[model samples]
Target: MVQSDSKLHEVALQKLNDRGVELKEIAELVYDLQSPYLAELTMQPCLESVKAVIRKREVQNAILTGIELDVLTEEGKLSSPLQEIIEEDESLYGIDEILALSIVNVYGSIGFTNYGFLDKTKPKLIKRLDDHTHSNKTHTFLDDIVGAIAAAAASRLAHDNPGISKIMK
Candidate 1:
C-alpha cells in the first residue's frame, strides 16, 4: 500500500541520512530513554514508534529544513554574517531550538520534557553533532534537530504503548 505522503517522508528521511543522521540510531536512542519506563520495550516497537513520528509532515519538514541549513553551513554557502553565526553556533541563536520545537510539540508534554533532557545531555550522536571545534563540519542546528527527533520518538512510544502508562503507576 503506497500512500502519496509516504514518498515525502521517505525523501525527508533520505535527506537526513545523506547528512549522516540515521533513523536507526535515533530509534535506538528513543528505545534507551523509554525502555526503562516501559519494561516490555524492544527495538522493533521503538523503531515503529520512531517511524510513526517521522511520518508526520511537520516532522519531515523540520528535519529537511534543519539538515539543509547544516549542509549549507558545512559548504560555506550561506552569506557572510549568517554563515559565521551558523558555523560558530552562537549561544544567542535559538531559531534552531524553535524549529526543533515544532517536532516536540507534536507528541505533547512528554516531548518537551524529553527534548529538554536530550538537548542538555547531548548523548552519543547528539554530542558528536554538536562538537564543531574538532571537525570542519558544523552541526549548529543539527544537534537540536536530532535531539528533537529522538525526543519525539520517545514521546510517541510512551504515548502509543499502554505499557508505559502501567509502569507509571
Candidate 2:
C-alpha cells in the first residue's frame, strides 16, 4: 500500500475503534461463518482475512463514510427526516445496506449470501452494535459495515482455502 493508502487504512481502523468495534469482534464473526465449513480452522486466518479486507481502499471509504454518517446522526447534526430515518434505522432506509454491499461486493457472490445471513442473524457483536436502546449512539451504518467486513473476510477465507471443496468434488 502507498503512503496515502496506509493513511486511509489507519484512519479507517481508528474510526472503527472510535465506534467501539474491535477486530476480534469481526474475526469472531468470520469464524462463525467459516468454521462450520472448514474441517479445521483457527482464528489466525480469520483475523488475517479481516485485515486484508480492511486494507482495501473500497472498504476504507465505506468505513469512513458510514461511520461519519452514524456519528453525525448521533450528534444530531444531520437534517430532518434523513436524520430520523438513519437514527431509527427504518426498514425502508436501505442506504446503509447498500453502502455495506459495496464492501462485500469486493470479494464475490459468496459475500452477498454471507452478508445476508449475518444481517439477518445479528450475531453477538453485531447485535450489540445494533442496539439503540442502551445508549445515544447510532450504529445504523456501523453494524452493517461490521457485518460486511465479516462477510467479505469470510468470502476471502473461502477463496483462499478451497481444499475442502476440492476434496468434496
Candidate 3:
C-alpha cells in the first residue's frame, strides 16, 4: 500500500481501537455486509469521504455542541426545566446522532446502516472506553462524541475497502 494509505489505515485503526471497537469485529461486520455483485458499487475510491466528515473542524463542532450543554449544567446557566431535560441526553437532543450520521452518510445508505448497527451494538471496547471517560471526571460528553467518530471511521473503512470484507471471510 502507499505510505499515505497505510497511515490513514493506521490512524483509523488506532482511533477505533482506542474507542473500544475491535478490528476483527469491525472486519467481520464488513464481511457480513458485503455482496459480490455489489462490489462495483463500493465507495472505496472515495476512501477519504468519511474521514473528511470527521475532520478536526467537524469533531470540534460536535464537542462544542455537547460541552456547551455540559457547561450550562455546571454553571447553572440553564433554567431548571431545561437543565433537567438536557442532562438526560433526551430524544430531542439527537443532534449528536445527527452529526454522527453526517459522517457516515458519505458512503451511501450502507454506511448509515453500518453506523446504526455499531452504535446500537455498543461492543465491549466502546462501552469500556465510554465508562473510562465518565469516570475520569473530565469532559464526559466526549465519551459518546468520540465513540461516534470512531464508529463512523470504522464504517468508512468497511465501505471503502472491499479487501477488508474478503479478509473477514
Candidate 4:
C-alpha cells in the first residue's frame, strides 16, 4: 500500500494534470529561468524547500483557511462585518499567497514571477478551483488549494532539475 504522504502526492499530481499543467512543463520552466543566485542552491535544495512547504502543514493551513471562509459564507454564520471582511479576499489577508511565496522564494525572484503567473493565470485546476466557489461542498476551496500547492511544489521540483522533465516527457 502507498503511504498516506505518497497517496497525497499522487492525488495532487492527478489534480494538477487534470487542469492541464504537466510536471515536465513546470520543470522546464524552472530550469530555463534559473539565475546565478538561484543556480548556486542546486535543484535538490530548491526542491527540498518546496517540499518543506507542503510537509510543514503550511499548504494544509492555507486550504483550511480558505475552506473555513467558504463554510462561514455558506452557513450564513458570518456576521455582516466578518462577511464583508472575507468577501474582499483582502490585501491584508494575503497570508495564503504569502505561504505560497515561501515555496518560490527558494529560487529567488524568478520563483516570484512564476508564482504570480500561476496565480493570475489560474491555469487548469486553479481555474476549476476558483469556479468551485459557487458550488456547495465540503472543503471546496481547501481541496483545490491543496491541489494548487501540490502543483506549485511539483513545478518547483521540475524547475530545480531539468532531468526530471526528461523523465516526465
Write candidate 2's Cα lDDT for 87-146 as tens digits: 899988899999999999999999999999999999999999998889789999999999
**Superior by lDDT: candidate 1 or candidate 3:** 1
TM-score of each: 0.90, 0.95, 0.51, 0.48
Residue 71 miss distance in model 2 (angstroms): 0.6
For candidate 4, write residues 1-169 as lDDT tens digits.
6336656555555544544445444443333334332434345544454455455444534544555666676676789866655454544655556545654454456455556766666555455545646644333344335434444554555455565343444
For residue 111, what is the lDDT in candidate 3?
62
lDDT of 3 by residue, 84-166 (tens): 65555565766557766655554466666656765676554345533433543222344455445545554555555656454
Once fitted onto the true fold, the runs of candidate 3 whose alpha carbons sit more than 4 angstroms away are 1-53, 91-93, 125-143, 167-169
Q: Give candidate 1's error at residue 151 in angstroms.
A: 0.7
Sort all candidates by lDDT, best to worst.
Answer: 2, 1, 3, 4
Model 1, span 45-79: residue lDDT tens: 87788788889999888887888898898898999
Better of 2 and 4 by lDDT: 2
- Lowest lDDT 10-residue stretch of candidate 1: 160-169
Distance (Å) between predicted and true CA of 166, model 4? 10
Worst 10 residues of 2 by lDDT: 160-169
